[model samples]
Target: MSRGAGTAVGVLLILTGLVWAGQGLGLIGGSFMTGQTRWLVIGLAVASVGAALLAFVRRRGG
Candidate 1:
């Protein structure tokens, strides 16, 4: 992927992770999803994915 595209993907992953975290923590508010722990688990996984994407962005020729 192009450098910009890779960076954007990385950023998006990080944001998604944060949102999932909020949902899990019940901090998102506004009656979004119906579960708590579920959000948390999903958030954690997304965050890991984001971190991996970031790593990918930082790798040589990425």
Candidate 2:
């Protein structure tokens, strides 16, 4: 994907992951994910991937 597209997707992934993590951790309750450690771990992994994508794009100078 183009740099701009990649960046946008990466940011979106990060935001979504944060929300999921919050929900999973009961920090932002009101859903089935609340207090779910599994979701929290999954969200963290997704966020890390997003971060890695951003870093890769930047490193590639694209």
Candidate 3:
């Protein structure tokens, strides 16, 4: 994918991960993931990957 598209996807993933984590922790509520530790962990991992991808791309002059 193009650099811009990749960046957009990375941002989206990060935002989604934050939301998922919130929902999982019952902070956002209104979903099956509420109070689910597994989802919370998954969200954090996804957010970390997204952040790392963004950093790597930026360092490479994407």
Candidate 4:
């Protein structure tokens, strides 16, 4: 993907992960994932991947 597209996807992933994490932690409610440990773990993993993608893009001068 293009640098711009990658950046956008990374940011979106980070935001989505944060929301999922919040839901998992019961900080943002009304979802089936609320208070779910599995969701929390998944969210953290996704956020980490997003962060890694952002870092890689930046490092590559993209």
TM-score of each: 0.80, 0.93, 0.90, 0.93
- Greater-lDDT candidate between 2 and 3: 2
Which structure among the candidates has the greatest lDDT?
2
Clashing pairs in 2: none
What are the Cα lDDT values of the candidates?
0.78, 0.89, 0.85, 0.87
**Residue 54 Cα positional deviation in candidate 2, in Å, after optimal superposition:** 0.3
Q: How many clashes in candidate 4?
A: 0
Candidate 4, which ten residues in sequence have the lowest lDDT sum? 53-62
* Residue 28 local lDDT, model 4: 88
lDDT of 3 by residue, 1-62 (tens): 66787788779889989988988888988889999998899899888888987877777775
Candidate order by decreasing TM-score: 2, 4, 3, 1
lDDT of 1: 0.78
lDDT of 2 by residue, 1-62 (tens): 88998898889889989988998899998899999998899889889889998998788877
Q: Which parts of model 4 have CA positions greater than 4 angstroms off?
A: none
lDDT of 1 at 58: 78
- In model 4, the Cα lDDT at residue 38 comes to 82
In candidate 4, what are the lDDT values of residues 1-62, reduced to their tens digit? 77888898889888889988888888989989999978888888888889988888888875
Runs in model 3 deviating more than 4 A are none
lDDT of 3 at 52: 82
